[model samples]
Target: MRATLIDDLPDEKLATAVADLVRPGGRWRKVDRGYTQAQQWIVRWPDGRSVFVKSGTDALTWGWLEAEIGVYAAVDAPWMPRLVASAGDGQGCGPVLVLEDLHEAQWPDPWEDTMVAAVVATLEEVHARTAPAGLPPLSDRRDVLHGWPLVARDPRPFLSTGLAGARWLERALPVLEAASARADLSGDALLHLDLRSDNICRHRGQVKLVDWTWACRGNPVFDTCAWLPSLHAEGGPRPERIAPGQPEFAAMLAGYFCSQAGLPPQQPGSQRRAVQRAQAAAALPWAARELGLPDPGDAPREGVPR
Candidate 1:
């Protein structure tokens, strides 16, 4: 029987394509998302060991998780998933990655203090590694964010017109550009641009970091900054209104600095505040634009905000 192609395949078709890769009798179950861009699956082997398979278009940005395989190949840690096998014909529409399953891992609520410490330590160690040249730098700063393509791939057909949606992308471009100019391009160390807790799992008394596509060489502080707001929220979920200079932000800064080189906490003063405000202003606009919704503020101007 001819194998099914991976391109543009809906869930059913993609499931068929994946079946060809796994052993017979291996049942496949789809994993829901709070994280990532690829379609995830849980495959149970005859021996009962489960593995995960991810599939998506071959776009460099969406295909970033493939980079995680390479990264895991380069780094040494007991906490990260071991890359099993990856197959992709860059020319064909079918690109797939198969990795060791982490179905047994579980993370406690409020995140254990040791777990948090371990995560910070891992980030510090990973960020210290030298990164390959020619790849984009991993920065959470404006420069890093701006350097990425403004248009992300949108599979959906419509756009949102809500206030939270309209002002998001429309107001964000300028802020991103301005932040990029002042961003630190120094110290090309390997960094995980996204370190949200959802990507972390606890297994066998160890913590594992998943999702590696956004990993790059850049300033570590920005990566630290990204984790602060989310990790400190109630139940580790982001809050609707996070006041500046709050204890939550302070704890994140303390965790980051103390976990690594012990630098004093960088207060989220004007500069960081500006970045936050700019980001908040941009979110709604981005959502609207992503859905292809009409923006009332789509006027052309010399110095609108960037």
Candidate 2:
């Protein structure tokens, strides 16, 4: 009863794989309630040290997690947790990771401006470092959100309901297409593409980032947008959605600019516009597919959004 894939693979297969990865004197325990996959677990060693583990076999997920370790290691910031150990190749059944467990740390709820600022500033600092000129580029918005077959073809069935939702989705399409046109997969930055609150922790008065599945080199603005949904989800004392054009976003940008020094700030208006555009671009294609609307085919703007 350790952990098993949602693909309905036999529990024995998963247990065997977990057993193979569990080191001597280490135990893997199931941690129910996962966002991405069903087999998430906390691996505990006899010495009382523990690392979190998540598994998947689609693309470069295991490799991406490893790449995240590389990103944090390369950064000079104090915000990232130390890497422990990871398992898995590119494919098959048992690929997983065992990393430092920052249990005492908790995520910033509703992502207050202060929390957003701290993360933005930290990312800015991370982005400032120089790297080898050509690292294979990280996946963009489409790649991150829609790589799965269900997501790639259509997500509206899973994301929305009713005609009103459909209209909102429709209104958002052209903007999505336009923004995607500007997406450059070749752009590089110190990116934690999945910068949601769950993957971040506040430990001993320091902020630490975890969950590097979507980490990569790319445009920093794209990084901001990628983090936006979760940040918006975390905004406010009660933890509600952050409305577009709020002062909180301004503060977040202020913190990022403060850390970045020479970086030009994205105007709040422009950022909101970009958000709306990105939302549409990010959602519409799949929505159309979900609704049985014919795919418009890949235009110049139909590629992944950076």
Candidate 3:
């Protein structure tokens, strides 16, 4: 679980380990975006072939990286990144996951309506595919839903910023909890818990989903519903248009993000808290709109919160 960067390893050893998977003489260039838990790089082979590499030495990230390898190995969908190679023990040096480099792929910009529809369709296709049973269950997120009850007892994190009045937030907690409890988070289909724009790409006229660390067996609709807050915050259509008639599911997700947003920062240079806060802010209004409650106003634009 020690923090180990690619530079910490001998060049020859690293090359030898990856040689079987990619062209032997490829160069590694760090990819500086959307990688929080691991070191990521795009490896370009001298032959013009390329692959994306994600390596993690910390226990949390290594575990997720390993899970990603399993998910990739288990599924064969066009919308997913093809797995190239992987290395690691369950523990120790951790794991390195290499995947197909999506050539000429571009991240969605301004999130036009057509692009949003494409993303939703792609997600639906992924959910339609049967998921292998051994994957982690959605029940693992139970703590996230149950955490709302505790917020009333300790309101410091939720009140520290004064973004929403403490009194209003307190009054909404019970309603949020009730709606969250009614949500059906269980399902047989695979769910991509993280579906932000950073993890999605468009290439060859198709949408592709990436970052399988949070992949799980859950209500597929939850995946689509959860994406609304981020989509709206990023200039896409409102939540009602993206996912309509799912107020309970939206409420559950709002609680999840709001609870996480309240926590203190977990690491140096980490934007997890800020991102969660933005999502929470964005989600509140959607939930309120669905529940016929007063609007909480616009959330900060999507990205790392300033």
Quick one: best TM-score, which candidate?
3
lDDT measured at residue 17 in model 1 versus the true structure, 0 to 100: 52
Quote the lDDT for 184 in model 3. 84
Tens-digit lDDT string for candidate 1 (105-143) = 775456766776777777777767687655565434432
Q: Which prediction has more favorable TM-score, 1 or 2?
A: 1
Of candidate 1, the 10-residue stretch with the lowest lDDT total is: 154-163
How many clashes (backbone atoms < 3 Å, residues ≥3 apart in a chain or on different chains) does model 1 have?
14
Q: Give all candidate RMSDs, comma-separated.
A: 12.9, 12.7, 5.2
Ranking by lDDT: 3, 1, 2
Alpha-carbon shift of residue 202 in model 1 (angstroms) = 2.0
lDDT of 2 by residue, 1-306 (tens): 112223223245444555565554346565543344424666666788776655654455555655654554555467767655545441246455555666546567545567666776777776665443434455434433322233224534323321123333344344333343334444656666666566777777777877665566766655665565435434422111222322222222222221222123344322333333333333333333333444432322222222
Residue pairs in candidate 3 whose N, alpha carbon or C atoms collide under 3 angstroms = none
lDDT winner between candidates 1 and 2: 1
The lDDT for every candidate, in the order shown, is 0.50, 0.47, 0.74
Pick the lDDT winner. Answer: 3
Candidate 3 lowest-lDDT run of ten: 1-10
